[model samples]
Structure formats: C-alpha cells, structure tokens
Target: MAAVELTVFQVILLFWSLRTAVSQVEMRCPSSCGNICIPYPFGMEEGSYLDERFKILCNSSSGVPKLTVDGTKLEVRDISVRRSTIGVMFPVVSANCGGKDRNTVVDLEGSPFVFSSENYFIARGCGNLALMNQNQSTIGVCVSICDKNRDSMMASCSGTDCCQTTIPSFLKVFNVTMKGLDDGKGSSGEKQCRYAYLVAQSWINYGSYYSDVGGDSDPYDMRHRDSVPVVLDWGIDERVFESLVKNGSFHNSSYSSTCQFLNPSINSTNQSSTVQCSCRPGFEGNPYRYGICEAGRAYDNYRRKIKAKMAGIGVGVGFGALFLLIGLWWLYKVFKRKRSEKLKKKYFKRNGGLLLQEQLSSGEVSVEKIKMFPSKELDKATDHYNVNRTLGQGGQGTVYKGMLADGKIVAVKKSKVIDEGNLRQFINEVVLLSQINHRNVVKLLGCCLETELPLLVYEFIPNGTLYQFLHDPNEEFPLTWEMRLRIAAEVAGALFYLHSAASLPIFHRDIKSTNILLDEKYRAKVADFGTSRSVSIDQTHVTTQVQGTFGYLDPEYFQSSQFTDKSDVYSFGVVLVELLTGQKAISFKRSEEQGRSLATYFIMAMESNCLFDILDPQVVKQGEREDVLMVASLARSCLRLNGKERPTMKEVTMVLERIKKSENLTVQQESEYDRKEVMGAPWDVTSASTISSFDIGAPSSLDEKPLLHTY
Candidate 1:
C-alpha cells in the first residue's frame, strides 16, 4: 500500500513538472506599447526580450502610451519582425545662422540598429546649403535655391527652396549642418531659417506635411513638427544565438522551424559580427519567441489529420492499409519539400547570393529597388525557357520574352555555364543596374539565383536592337536620319549619366549598336551590362582584363588594359561611324586599303574630303549637309586614338544637344521661308566649303585645330 502511494505521488510530481515547463514556454508578455507592436527579441521589460539592446521604454504621462528607444528617446512608430525594420520619429535640426542654432546629432553607437538607405536627407530654406556629416566627414550635401520672384515663389521642393538626396546605408550616426550661402543673406535681407533632417523616402512622398501648405507657409516647412518618420534596420548577432543553442539555453520551440540566419561578411577588427534573422517560408510571427511562429493553412491541415488519426486509432485498425498509404504519401511530400529547399539554398550560396547580401548589408548597393525572385516563378514565366520564347542569344547568355503571373511582360536573361571567374561580373551587373534610375538605361526588374545559373529580369523592349534597324532594314518601319540622330543623342545622354550623374561613376566597357535596344516609342535603352563596372568618384580609370567587341574596342584599353570613361567614348564613336556608313563595324568584303574596319574607312573618307561619297545614300538624301558634317566631326573627335584626346560623354551629349537644337531652329526658319516664298534658294555644293563649322567641345587636345576643319 505504501509503494502504491509512492507511485501515485511520483506520477503527480512528473505531471506538475511537465505543466510547469509548458507554462514557462508559453509565458505571456506585453505585445504592444500604444499603437506599436513589440515583438520578441524586442520588448518593454527585462526577461521579456532577448537582450538589453532590444529593451524599450513605454511612457504614458502624455495620455497616450509612447514607445522610446535608448537614451535618445526616439519615439517608435512601428516594428516589423518580417522585414527587421523599425520606424522611429527622429527630430529635425534647424539652424538660424547668426542666431540660436539647433544642430542635432543622432548617435546609435552601441545599438543593433543602422539607418536604412531608403531614407533621404533633405534641406529646406532659400539659398541654404545643407551638409550631413558622419564621423566628422561630409557624407551628403544639397543646396536649396530661392526663386528671384518673391511674390510668386515656387512652393515645391524641386531644387527651389528645398533639395533632397539619399543617405548611405549601414549608417549608425550622423549630424546635419545648414549653412547659409553668402553669410545667411536672404532676398529680404533677413536671416533665413534652414531645416535639415533624414526622413523615410516613402513617408516624404505620401505624408500630409507636403500638402499642408497654406497662406504664406513654405511647402517644405517643418517647423510646426518636432520630428519625422525614419526607418531603422535592426538585426541580432548570429554568434549570440549560436552560443545560446550550444549552451542548451535557447527555448524558442519554433526557432528551428521558422527562422533562418542571414550571414553577412564579418570584419572583426572594424565592425561587429552581426547577422539578421527572418522567419522561414510558410511561417509567421516572432521568430525569437517560443512557439510564436504559427504554421500556415497547409501545416494546420496536416496537424488536423494527425489529431484525427490519433483519435481514431482503434477505427484505423480496420482501414490500416488506407491509413498507411496516406501516411506514406504525406511523408513523401515532406521529404521532397525538404530536399528541394536544401537544393535551392545550395544553389543560392553557390550563385553569389551571400556576396550580394554582404554588399547590401555594407550599404555598397541599395536593396530597395532589387527583388529576389523564386526559381519556380521564373520557370513558369518563361514556360521552362521554351524555344519559341527566345528573344536573342549572345556570348554571355540568352534572353527570353516572358509574361509574369501578373501579366507583365519582361525580358529574362539566363547566363551560360559561367565559371567562378565570371561570377563577379554577373553580380556586378546586378549591383550596377540596381543603382541606375535614368530613363534611357535598361531597368532591372529583379533576379533569380536559386537555379543552376542566375537569371536577370528586365523591362521588355518591343522594338529590336539599333543594330537590327540599321543593318537589317524593315519595310514596315524605316530608319530615318532624324530617328538615328535622336537615338544617338539618347545613347550619349545615357553614357553621360553613367559617367557623371550617378551616385558612383559607372564605366560601360561595351558600347555597340547591338547592345542598344529600342522600346515601342523608339527610345534608346542601353542594355548589356555584364561587363560594366562602377568606380569611385575620384578614380579616373580601372585597370581590368581587356574585354570588348573587336571593332568597337578602344585601342588604348586593348594595349594598357586600363579602362577609363574614354574607352566607352571610343566604342560610342564606332557606333556613330556605323550610323553614318550603315555598314558593319568589321567587314571582310571591304578592300585591303579599308583594312576591313569601318572606323578606319570613315576616317580615311573624312581625310580625303569625300566623306559624303562613302556615306549611306539615304543619309545624304534625308539629312542636311551641314548637320551631317557637324555629326561626322563629333564622331571623329570621339574616335581619337589617344583616349585622353577623345571627348568625354558629357561633352558629346552637350554638343549633340546643341546640334539638335540648331536643327530644330533651322527647321522652323526654313518652314517660315517656304511659306513666304514659292521657291527656296538652291545649294551650290561645288563652291560651298567642304566642312561646316560647329563647336564639338573637344578637350584642350583638339584646341590646336578646328574639329570640322580639313585635315
């Protein structure tokens, strides 16, 4: 009897211990502070969060509960566990120049948060120059200009009284200074109040502050508010979680099933070894909490089946075979899913996903514009890369026309069997393309890296390449002189943007007619960036392996392997020659004297004073003689053997714009003259000068001789 009583006592003790463990695992904590939901790893009290850094304070003295972070008391607006981002209200710094200045400094020194690149640094005031400094170094600058007209001052932040620029990624702390131009002297001789701050880009676009302009208030005036919304990216260190796992202290039951570690490259000497944790597919909720990530509907259905089977165990004996088959099928599906996920992860790592992630985390590349597409989605979009969907094939890869699930048409580029050496180039293309926002540059919609080869998705251009239009004539759509000139101007503008206007200077190593695509509107969109590279602002050249189309390749780059922006100019010059002659860059059918090169042939024709003789008959017929001569001169300047002697893309763009403007004005004048007189003056080509005079804007190297003068 005593033994039996002891057994009952032991059973109760075991049940009590089990219940206690379950209770600890399911312990409830405050989920929110006012409107912001505080998900674990982040909490309002000790023992509720993963670490001291994630602790937040809730203040309700102002009637409404407010969540604040660290000693800065930055008000928390929202927290997203899925995106690992927190929205906080950051104060705007105002400076009154010669008066009381309110320059603010934000320091997040020891926190796990970094300022997101999706925020923009804005400065608002007339004739004020704002500079954002980090670690005493100027990181960003923008100048606001006031309109000369006082009564009709523009109420827009489009560089008039307000200017905005993007902030760098991985930024932890920064300060803003608003310096007035000419010692704060305003049009009214009154000291101007300049406001500067970093705000979420999306918030600036949709916020009510911009639309709240009334009476004489400035449109960008933020004096009424103390702060604006800013985005902060937060992540936990991978080592901390790994240590917990090793010590058997991590109690999050759903962590293994829901969370995956984002391993960014770590620099122990200079930076913290931090990593991001995100919930896995088919799961939702806090990954840092015990059993918080709830399963999706499919998982819930599977659980229901298990529960049903357990409840009907006795009945299942009669239909044992049927139950066994269902169990086997379910097991097969689960195994297949796990295997597929493992393979995808392997491919992702192999295809430079981790390297790209490092670049993104380091703020070297902006992540807002690029998307990671799933392999299955791309496969379906391209119909398994059907032959019929093929758009074009190149040495680098093949492009396919695809329709996404949303019925959006895109051009998908699938790389060939690239070795590890070329992998960096592939990734380089993705990073460089993501940063570009010019209209004439091809838009990178997204990419897929989980397959054997990486895939890049771009906006589809309905019209074919410029090379096809120039070399392969179409009866339905003829290439006119005006269209060619417009295309040339647009291409030059794109190259200029790459070289000068971008956040970083980009060198398009390959610039050929075949690489320039035309959209439905016949607008030029520069494509094929597999060989492109971005250089620092101070870097004049990048020494790389000589790679370019033979005829279009810069001679200096081929010999020295030092590629500068001028290398691209040389290639563009060849494209110009192609436009003028309407012949292949390299033709074996040409005579030995022409050296099988169109560039050489065109130069020879120009020197011999018979450029028109070699020019396409259609070009001579449709284009004005003087306009043709001016363009030919510009092309010659660009094709200079010495890279330094060649005109920059900026100079080329300016000269082309001037020529186009002149053509427009001349056309208007000619139209008026024809209306006034029945017959127009005839041209005397024999007596007229062989070369037309126009400013080519060539570098000082060309100052010795006129661009259009006879050799």
Candidate 2:
C-alpha cells in the first residue's frame, strides 16, 4: 500500500509540472483582444508584458476595442510572433487633381521599432517618380511611366503604370515624395493623381489596384486610399543577452530558448546591438515567457508510443523496434544527401564549372583568394535570390544584397544565361578580376557556378553611383568641384593601376561615371568589369566587335574595330567632361548644333571660347580658373581623333594627382588664414570681416588664358 501511494504521488507531481509549464504563457495576461488571441511577449495589460516594447494598447473609446502600439497610437492590423514583425495600417499620401498634394512622412527614430526588409516603397498612378528619403539622403526611387495597358498593373506594381522598390532594413524614418513625370495628365487622358505608400509584401497582389477598373480607368478615385499595411521589426538589446549568457545564467532564466544575434552589418538606430530570442529546435512556443516552450507534437507522439511499447511488450521486442526505426531514418538521410550531391554535380558541369576549375589550376588565379561557393549557401544568404533582395540591375546582370554565413554583407551578381560564344569570356573575367586588387576597384569576394548560370559576389558599397549624385535632382548635396577633382584623380589612378600594375595589361573598356561608385566619404570606386579585357604582354590591342557606350566610345575604336589601352582614355575623357559640365554623356534634349555627344559640345564650347558658358555653376564657383583650364586641356588631349595621340593613363594620372595636391595646399592655406582671423579679430570686427571675406572670395575671369590656346 505504501509503494502504491508513493508511485501515484510521483506521477501526479510530473503531470502538475508539465501543466504549469504550458500554462505559463497566459498567466496574469489578457489572452484576447476583441476577436484576436494575444500571445506571450505581446500583452494587453501592464504587468503581463515582458517589457515595454511588448505592450499592445487596446483603445475602447468607440465601444469596440482596437489594437494599437503603446504610446505611438498607430493602429495594428495583425501581429506575427513567429516572424518578429507587426502589421500596421500606415497612411498613404497622394498628389491629386482639384485637391492639395499630401506628403506622408513616417518617423520611427528613438523607438525600438524598425522598418522590415520585406516591405516595399510602392507608387501608384502613371507618369510619376516616387522618392523615399531619410536624413536628407535619398534611399530609394522608382519611376512609373504612363501606361494605357492597365492589365500589367493589375498583376503587380510593375514599372509601367505602377512602380515598386524594396527598402533597406534598419530604417528608422522615411518620407515619401511624389512628382509628376508627364504634364499632370495620365495616358488614360485624365488628370492622374499619384499615390505612394509603404506596404507589406504579402498583402499585395494582382487585384490590389486594377480589379474594378479595366485597362482604361483610374484606380485612385482621385481622393487616394487612406492607409495600407506595413511591417515593422522588434528585438531586445544584445547587451542583456550577452551578460546573461556569459555568466551562465541564461539557462536558468529561460528553458528551451536560444539567443540569436542580429547581423552586425545590418544598419540600426540603436547605439548598442540587438538580439532575437527564439524557441530551441524541436520545441515551439513564445520564448519570451519562462518555461513556456513545449515539445513538438511529433516528439510528444513518439514519446507516448515508446512508453506504450515498453508497457505492453517485452524489453527485447521494444528495443528491436526502436533500432529498426533508427536504421530506416539513417537510410533516408543518406538517400537525401546523395540526391542533393548528384544535382549539384549536374549543375556544376552545365555552368562551365569544370572549365573554370581548369583555368584556375593553370596558376593565373589564386584558388585560396577566389572561393567557389555552393549554390545552397548563397540561396540561403540571399533568401533564395528573391526579387526583393535586388540591389541594382544592368545589362550584364542584377546584383542582390546578401549576408554570408560568416556575417559579411556582399553584392551577388546573378548574370543572365549566356550563349557558348560568351562562356569563355565570362570565365576569363573571373580569372582576371580575382587576380587584380586595387583600392578603387570593387573587390570580388567569390563566385558560385553550381547553378544554371554563374554568380559572382563582390563587397557591398553603400552609397550610390556617381551618375546619381550628378543627375538626380532629389540629391540633397551638390557635387563640389573639390570632390569631382578628387574623384577624377582616383578613377584615373585606378585605370593606370589596371594597365601597368597588373601582371597583364587590362583595359576597362566601360569607363563611365555610371560605373563609378562612391563611398560614404565620396571616395570613388571603379566597378562593372563585365566588358573589361586583359591582353598578354606581347599584344598591343585586341580587335573585337564594337562594344562600348555611344557618347563615350573612342572614334578610332568605333571606325577601326581595334581596342587599345588608349580607347579607355577616350571614355575617361568623356567622364571628365561630365564632371566639368554636369551634362549627361548623351542627351537627346540638346539642340542639333550642340551635338548629342557631351565631348563634342564641350570641344566646340572650348574652341568658341565659351567654355564657362556650359560649365556647371557649382564648379565655376568653387574651382580656380587655371585648374579648370588645365583639366579641360587634358580632356581635349585624351579626346584626340587618333588613339596614339591620346595621353597614356599613366601620364593622365600624374597630372590629376598634381592638380589635387595643388588644390589641397590652397585649401589648407585658406583654412589657416581664416583660423588666424578668427583667433585675432575683435568681436565687433568679426562679423564685418566675415562679410568682406565672402566678397573677396569670388573667382575672377581674368585669372587664366583661353582654354583653346592653353592646350
């Protein structure tokens, strides 16, 4: 009787503990809000929440309760505990006819919340450019053209009548501005209203805009929709997790919970780091609650089966069944792995992986430096190369932003499928780029060939291309003369290094402003080596098909089909012209006499002694007359009719460096003079002196000789 009672007590105690663990999630918390069940980590009342960030306010003023973010008053549509995101009905802005234009700005700074990466900046209506900006810098821009065929807009926010672009994560604040590209009239012959908003990825589909209206009608109703759902991410401070984990106290604090550090390279408003808490593998529940993680249904069922087998049969029979089950599981895993390997091998051969291996082994490329990544790993890093992960797209391919397993952010280039003629050239690029290393050149991190088409990974650059800074009117800061000069010198130096410093001479046939990237400090990084060529020591030039941008292409190369190192000089000269004049390399808007080519117009202006007439006002204001003339003269020399007449990249690099040093010295002297005046001047005289300094600092036209005569 005593043994039976003891056994019964032990069984009861185990059952009570299990029940308590599962019930912990709802203890002292309001489990429901209206019709929705509130989960752990997210609570309606004060004491139930793990922290203030988890507080979900229920507004009952209208006789019906509605969920809102605590203190923000932003209405919440839904909460996703698994995704670590919240769906909120964010307001959308519109520029409509017969009504005032509205700009919707969402500022999330100083809050623990951030915009989710899965969200997109979407714009609706035809002939509009939607711009999203933060901290006076443009984040994303999308242009919508007038489309009479609204069928395309019905399916997705395709770049026809509607446009969409993915926003980067860790964005605390952003403002949406919509401007008309047409004369305020859409292709539907209506006074089109532009609507722009931030919305969740899942909520968008074909029927969102054009279901009611066929290909001819307007969707905005001329009044604009009030709001749409957008996703926001939340996380805990990393310091707390680090402190608890390091002291071995985390295990005691929470059972079946794991700490996952957010990618360090991701942008964040928080001063410290952030981390996410998740239920351990084989368990599922809210990890924010203590001891709430429960075993998965499959695991619980398996345990019950084992207990039943042990109770009903002999120990030997039960053991034999368990061993057989384990053997079957092992075999299944082996078969799955073998199948995966066979697929990888098949893809490798199809993507010219064997040819790449042969080339790398020939001693041209350093195998250690140039990694060959598995396709699976890249797919995981880039979320299976989803369109939302795209960084930029060009003629060669699209570049997607990805985070490696080692926590490095990279730009993965997914090239379009190529014909057999281009296969050798693609492999050649990998070998050449892997061997060359220069500061201004984009660094190739690795490549992956285990797919139908190859992928190349390069270090991610944050700031946009030089063309954007020059051409984008929404750009907050104007490109200064000093910055342009420095960039010119940097680009010239990079080209020189490619030609002379590398083992084999390399010609960057696609040397244009668009291919040049700018870092945070505005340092130039020459990129896009898709059309580059590497010649052997004995070769002077490679005669190939005419391949280059029209305005920047060398006349000699275009006429003769021969590409020499000087061909790059002509392209570089065009970039220099763009820097001097803020005009595009090619523009159809220019008059017939002005010529389509910026180089031709610039030369004509110089010959006519009207160089200053076409120069950028910013450059004219900041640049010294002599420095401007010297750069113009160098550009003219580079744009010579004959390739042989063009100055070598080495000589061009030397002149630009000299000019940069001279400018630096002049700036230093001016700064010193200003400092002395500030230190020595009386309070009354200071203001007067500052005003006089500005008056005296203006450039004089008489400071240099004629640009045509100078060269």
Best by TM-score: 1
> Candidate 1 residues 553-652, lDDT tens each?
9888887888888889989999988888899899898998976888888887776667888887778898886667767777876787766557778878
Model 1, which residues run further than 4 Å from truth?
1-320, 664-693, 696-711
TM-score of every candidate: 0.51, 0.50
lDDT of 2 by residue, 1-711 (tens): 344347556765655565556456334334766655566567778878656666767655532224334344666766666566777777778877448566757677545567898888888777878888877777789888876756632455668767888987677775887777763452342357777878777666444645433343444322445666678887656665566566543443455667666653344454345666777766667665543355544354554665576466544556557666557757877999998888778877776788888877777645556788888888999998976688888888889999999998888999888777887777777877887788888888888887777899888887889988888733577899999999999999999998888888998888988899987788899998888888887677788999989899988888778888878989999999999999999999998799888998987787666788889988899998767766776776678765555667777887787677777465444322243232233223113222123223422211222212111
When summed lDDT is taken over every stretch of 10 residues in candidate 1, the lowest stretch is 671-680
- Runs off by more than 4 Å, candidate 2: 1-332, 364-368, 664-711
With candidate 1 superimposed using the best TM-score fit, by how many Å does residue 55's alpha carbon deviate from the native? 86
Please give the TM-score that candidate 1 achieves against the real structure. Answer: 0.51
Best by lDDT: 1
